[model samples]
Target: MTAISIAPAATRIPSRHRITKVMRLQMVNRLTYLGIPWIITGVALVISIVVAVLISVSVPEPGRQAALEGMAYSWAGLSPFWYLAVVGVQAVSAIFPFALGFSITRREYALGTLVTFVVIAAFNATGWAILTEIERAINAAGLTFHHFTALWFSEVGAGSVWLSLFTLQIVIFAVASAFAAVYARWRAMGMLVLWTAVALVVLGLIAFALLTGSAVPIIDWLMGFTITGFFAALLIPATLAFALGWAALHRAPLRG
Candidate 1:
């Protein structure tokens, strides 16, 4: 019934946790949850930066090459993006679970979700930092940073200039939750189909508009679909739907 991310705290508590214990508990939980994301993010960032620098320094510059010569460098440039995506997916995987945990179990669930989001946040941050560092490194090398401008991309599958392009950690969680809800409610794939349809339509529109002129404004709006915009877009909805689910669950609580 409740989301794991935004459930309210219990009114009743033991005398031991009157104040200090409560504060201690919250802090402890926050730190405990944060550790995983931070560690994972750190590892991924380090590896990505090292790999990118290696590739960039190793690939010898050419006098003149084909149209796609930039593509090779582009590929080398993507290591950071890969690391970020890997970290991002991991981060996103925690979104619903954290929300679900917060909604259902009160403090315990909240704690779990907190830890998970910390991990997720860590990855998101890591992915971003790696890309920023890579760009700076490339700039320092006095080379052109190609295919990376503003905030849009040709495809989610293409280019790594930006980490969120490939994987918007928060959106995945939101979409995943929608899918899970559909699956649980009707054993249907309506959510999946809807998502697919939405993707196709959006992509088509972007392609058409791009052919005619820059669609940076449109793409920027769409970027809100990313985790960076999850709080603004999905969080409110997620919390609201979660509240409705809570009412239903209480009327007929989850079966043991």
Candidate 2:
């Protein structure tokens, strides 16, 4: 009689485990995601300080306080937030193909990318909040330098600052992810169409505002929102963009 042989069955990994693994894979390039952004922020802070000093020295004595107060309105401290959007694009355009080659499903990759965004947003938000407090302390010491706590943060508490930063980071990152997903699925033409549509929508909004004569009122209403409230309102668009990105990735080609 001939001997019979049995083949072992393939073991399936749990969904959560696979998702976490993909997240870890996305975080492999720490310098791109973390280091460069902070470096840019540091450089921006230094530049802002130098500018503040120069303004203090060059301006007439009576206007010195006014110039420094205006300097407190600078947006240099949030420089890293814009860079995070580029990081988001890189996360999808560069990393997706590698993950696919490793047998990662599109769903797993999407979840992993989203989780990575959340982690990064939280980390950066915490850092920004801490820096805001430190900036406040420096200003308190009669330095008159303000970088991290500019704009609406001039009137808000620490918790509001953190919430605003966290929400804004999510919104920026998610929007960039959506754009990157479009590029991944359709390349240059896709990006062109996306930008064209964006421009059209912006023009339409501008026309509407001009025709309706509500521009000033709209601006006033928007400016009326508290720091926390404004960022909270951003959650709506953030959710929509995040969902669009996830959906786009599901059909993206591995080679794009």
Candidate 3:
């Protein structure tokens, strides 16, 4: 009898393990997602404080109080949001190809990327909530500086603040993810077309609102939303963007 040769069956990784691995892979460069954001936040805080102090000093004492009080909103608090968009784009564009080379399936990569977005959004939101409270306390102590405590956040309770921030971050990240996925699938030309389409759509909407004389009504409708309600409404677009990103990545090439 001839000796029989048999090959062992290939071991399959559980979906959960594969997903977790991808998440870990994305986080390997923690500085991009975590450290840099905080650094930017800190820089923004410092700039806000400096500007507040300068304005206070520039004004007469009688007007200084009014000046600071009038600062209902600070753009500095929004700096991190912009950086988070970059993080979202890099999360896919920079990592998708690498992940594929490691034998990660497209499904696994998409799901893992989404999970990472949620985790990062939650983490950043928590930080923002804490900072908002701290800023509130500082302002209450009579400093009158606004960094994390934007006017909208000041109007809401703490829970609402956290929820709104979480929603906003998720929306920003999801939209960026969609853009990055499009880039991955079609390269630079895809991004150009995407942005052109976005610009035209925005212009069309503006033109419609202007010509139809519904701009005020639209503004009023939007302004009527409570802080939480506004962010919650944003969930619609966020969901669509997330879905679009996933679908795009489903067939994205490994080399891109």
Per-candidate clashes, comma-separated = 15, 0, 0
* Cα lDDT tens digits for candidate 1, 165-242: 323444443344344433333333644665687699889987988997768876777675754443345456545434
C-alpha TM-score for every candidate: 0.38, 0.88, 0.90
lDDT string for model 2 (1-256, tens) is 7767676767989999999998899888788878998899889988998898898889989998888888766788788888888888988888889999999999999998889888988898999899999989988888777788788887889999999999999999899999999888888998899899989999998999899998999899998987788899999999999888887789988762
Q: Please rank every candidate by lDDT, starting with the best.
A: 2, 3, 1
Better of 1 and 3 by lDDT: 3
Kindly list the per-residue Cα lDDT of model 3 for residues 129-221, writing each as its tens digit: 998898899888888877777768778888898888899889999999899999898888988998999999999999999999999999999
Residue 151 shift from truth in candidate 1, angstroms? 7.1
Scored by lDDT, model 3 comes in at 0.87
Which candidate comes out best when scored by TM-score? 3
> Candidate 2: which pairs clash?
none
Question: Which residue segments of model 2 deviate by more than 4 Å?
Answer: 1-7, 53-62, 213-217
Candidate 3 residue pairs in clash (backbone atoms < 3 Å): none
Best by lDDT: 2
